[model samples]
Target chain A: MFPSGHPERSAVERNGVEGSRDQTLKVPQRYSSTPLRSVRNDEKVSRHSSLCGLALGLVLIACAIPSAKAQDFLDHVDEALSFSALNGEVRARVSGTLDLEVYHFSGLSPGLIRTTNDTLFNPRLSLFLDAQLGPSVYLFTQTRVDRGFDPSDRGAQLRLDEYAVRVTPWEDGRFTLQAGQFSTVVGNWVPRHLSWENPFVNAPLPYENVTAIGDKSAPYYSFLGIGTPAEKYEHNPIIWGPSYATGVSVAGKIGQFDYAGEIKNASLSSRPESWPITRMDFANPTVSGRVGFRPNEMWTFGFSASEGAYLRPEAMSTLPFGRDPGDYHERLFGQDIGFAWHHWQLWAEFFEARFEVPGFTDADTFAYYLEAKYKFTPQFFGAVRWNQQFFGDVTNSYGGTAPWGRDLWRADLAVGYRFTAHTQLKLQYSFQHEKDGGNDSDHIFAAQFTVRF
Target chain B: MRCLVFCLCLLSALTRSAPAQGSVEGQVDLPRTKSAPVMTKRYEIVTTGGVLGTNPPLAVVYLEGSFPTSSNLPTKQVAQKDLAFVPALLPVQVGTKVEFPNLEKDTYHNIFSYSPAKRFDLGRYRPDEKPVPSQIFDVAGLVTLRCDIHEHMRGLILVLATPHFVVTDDSGHFRLKGLPAGHYTLKAWIDSRTTREHPIDLKSGSTLQVDFPATP
Candidate 1:
């Protein structure tokens, strides 16, 4: 049901010349420049854990809501009973990986960086429940617990990643209603979780938070709506409907080609006096869509684009320094042209953003990356990626090395081996060069293993 | 009464041709209820006569070391009466003649095959006292017998391979006759459930007993 075979117009199969507006991977951050240590605290983890417990408990209570015991007993005595059955099943999985990073510098000999750091392994646990309540209804639930490993932190923690409930009133499966915290249907790449759906072992750099957006960061696949109400609309009854497309979504079909649109609330500004304070409002709704073709069982191709504003806490926070504390309300635009053929895949996306803060005659920044990957076999593959980023002067006035100034070019090569379907080990090396000066280049060697059950 | 008498004579003549292996004994096993939400109290058994006669009432059902796959039925004419197909259950050999006589004055009837195993729509027929030349079912399987024009008229034509077979009566018991001494496999296939199979060694005159479990 994702996309019917439109082989010729798949997401990856496109002949149109790339336009200026078509930009790629941009990681939107919740708070740019804000220290990561500040946001990741013990309190937040504990609070989230409690909330997960309550939500799961509530779902359990909701399941025990109906019964007709007296009628069943009487029917048994009278030999007039009619009944169905209820059955449940559960499955679990666990996997891990290791990654080491080395570096390659441009205009210099290729060598390993002296400050080589490594990520030993990361494990994830997931529980899925499939239940058939009666003749007509069924329920599916998945819970994930993850342990992230960093050389600095020896301890690990689990998080309730997602909770969803899907209801089917009709057995033929024409209609369904789903509620809970789930993935938003945005760009094909944004919504697909790295561990769950992607063929590549590591996510693209632009798909990360540090580069794409100033503040709020969402990994290529993260979205949650706390009781937000949304419904889908379609002119043709059978072709389109909103069941899971909410908070952020992608939907619609053109001829044999299928397109999905995503919408999410972005940060906006109030009065000039409230400069540093970031308010969660409908500054702009990030709207994006992907149109793709799937001709047969083997291939898929798609083109995607989105325009909106993202929230950057550090930029929005009022700092005492004379420097403009930047703002989370950054106008952003993006376009991604991608296609995957059979087991082998390739894609490239570019992103550009502009800011209209007070002192800077408005600043514009651009970033783009080209990523290509091939799956040599089901268990092994390799990837190569290149990224280019540019930044504008802070003020229009004669610039004396304006507020911030520098551009960066980065490239990475990686090879991964999947020890099992749920576990993979990847080794990647990254090289970066500063167009200006100051710690301009960094050689990062990384090894990571991801597991899910 | 005269017609009934003639049918009985035909049944006697047919049963006589085959060696009659008398009485049989068996039981229908119902699974342990355990903690099932609903307890079934009453059950009903529907039987059909073999190629020769009406499924006999209270027939002695025995367990041959193995289950007998075939049940025989006569090809004789079964007329329409009071808007119902007479002798609703007809068990016949894989190749046998079945006569359908039109006895209704006001209604026409058509015996058709809608079952996947055997498919054929025997066109409609006018009311006539004379019987039409029989339909020979070459395939061995259950054929759901129905009427093309009448929605309520329904019946069954069970085409079988072996001649040794019988349908249980109201008490859920059945029997087969004249099974020679040998090792055989007895299997029972029920709708909406898995089939049961048991190895059975049948003897010249001995009766074997077996039970089949029914789930609620």
Candidate 2:
């Protein structure tokens, strides 16, 4: 991966380097680009909200039956009941998590955007329904209602983010086949992305930072350095958070090695509206996979790669005639490692992606983060993460190759305390700065209260 | 009639052997029901049950008043095996030195408790290490022990003020005998949050019958 101003810019391009542009101060239009696109985005949000309501309603109905005497039927399901009348094998359990978060970050800086209120607060809920059929088959789904799990979410809207069903052939979980809409398998963060698991409020730079590459249309590259930047915040990153694209996956643990592979309809950076199969097709499905090695219970290392079409079908008119959009794709490679010893837990990951923006040369970028958590006490803990993102070279409008975006790094410090086994409160503060920009307004303060039931 | 007369004579003689001490025996009225999940677990793999765990829903019965125990007592143990503390629930007298040994074949364990009764953090140790880690619980309160790594792993050490204590059997029955004649408070501890106590006048050589979850 090229580290910004490398002399061999053309060589990095040949080897698939990707560049990105970010504007933390610029406002992100929830529905971006032209006015027509914005209107469509609004409609899409309403449609998704309705769909989420229906799905959650179905999940609730499954927990009860129609009967005049069944007023409190669902609440009584604290224990799984195997009904002989129904083959005596069906047992179901419903559990959930509620997260209330408050965040305040300066929007008047070189980086730090995303809020309608000076002090913003929101509540997110995640419900899990698991039902076992006999000894080998099971059905499980996770439904979430969230207005951007964190402050990084562009707009304030609550919707279902993910749902999946998993199957295992044997009692021992050495093999599993999962289907439905689920998260990507390319990184180490997906497993602990939930509020109750992750200690931080904001995503890593790779997932949150916007690249000059846009999914809706041709990308706009900046001039040499950060001059003459893109006019709008219509850009994408190497990945937009945990890519919960609809797909099928197979994962298993054998001996000390674990492996997983996924085939999804949309690429990692596709917006939430395009995640559903009805909006996108598998003509050029994204294929991503990961292989991990665990020498022991204390340490794990993984390598992952993915290549797929990141452009949306609506952007077809923006490209030259007779060109297939899939030819210009997003290719990514990553490495992650985790170790837990005694009271210390550590994790680090490095990712580089190359986006072939239609008409323009490929954009190359790299992102990384190293985090460590210490258990200061049984009920309290402290964690810190060092994160940064750098862009390679891109041919600008003036016919010269230079970094298409600015580079930046951030340090996040967080502390958490568990009031009880089921409830915990986390507070975090971050210091961020661009390579040439000041950090006067780049400070971030956030807090989250999560309860699992 | 002759057999009944013989049984009465045997009971009378047994009472004379411990004339200076009283006893209490009872059955707890906690109904036998399936135990709900300890916490709301997300989509996870199958649970690998603990190697050593709590036996049936047992209760700890003890006297509540101060009763100084003898010094130079043996240190109690709560070993970490299969990523869990053996004997998930433990009851001990105040000042009992509790040892936490890592017994897993692989992986390390760090045993620590934030309970107000005994706040101690035994640093991490590899499996089967020499000299087990321990803490002498001097306070009379519930000490909840947990592994710093494995969040699901849990154990409890209930420290009592008096030396008279016994754990209930599978059928919820317990007997605490050989208590010096005195005015004492009898109590039952079901869990850290659930306990019932009642003042009692225990006379010499008398056996008092008690039942709980029935007005204390």
| C-alpha lDDT values of all predictions | 0.41, 0.67
TM-score of chain B of 1: 0.62
Report the C-alpha lDDT of model 1 over A423-450, residue by residue, as the tens digit: 3556677776766443356565554444
Off by over 4 Å in 2: A1-95, A108-113, A116-119, A129-140, A149-156, A220-233, A396-399, A436-441, B1-22, B36-55, B79-85, B101-114, B119-133, B145-154, B197-208, B213-216
Per-candidate fnat, comma-separated: 0.00, 0.14
List pairs with backbone clashes in candidate 2: A17-A364, A18-A363, A18-A364, A18-A365, A19-A363, A19-A364
Q: Candidate 1 lDDT, tens digit per residue, B87-176?
A: 665666667777777676434555655454465544445565344635777787766565533433545666656565565554555555
Give iRMSD, candidate 1: 22.7
Q: Which candidate should be chosen as best, given lDDT against the real structure? A: 2
lDDT of 1 at A247: 35
Docking quality tier of model 1: incorrect
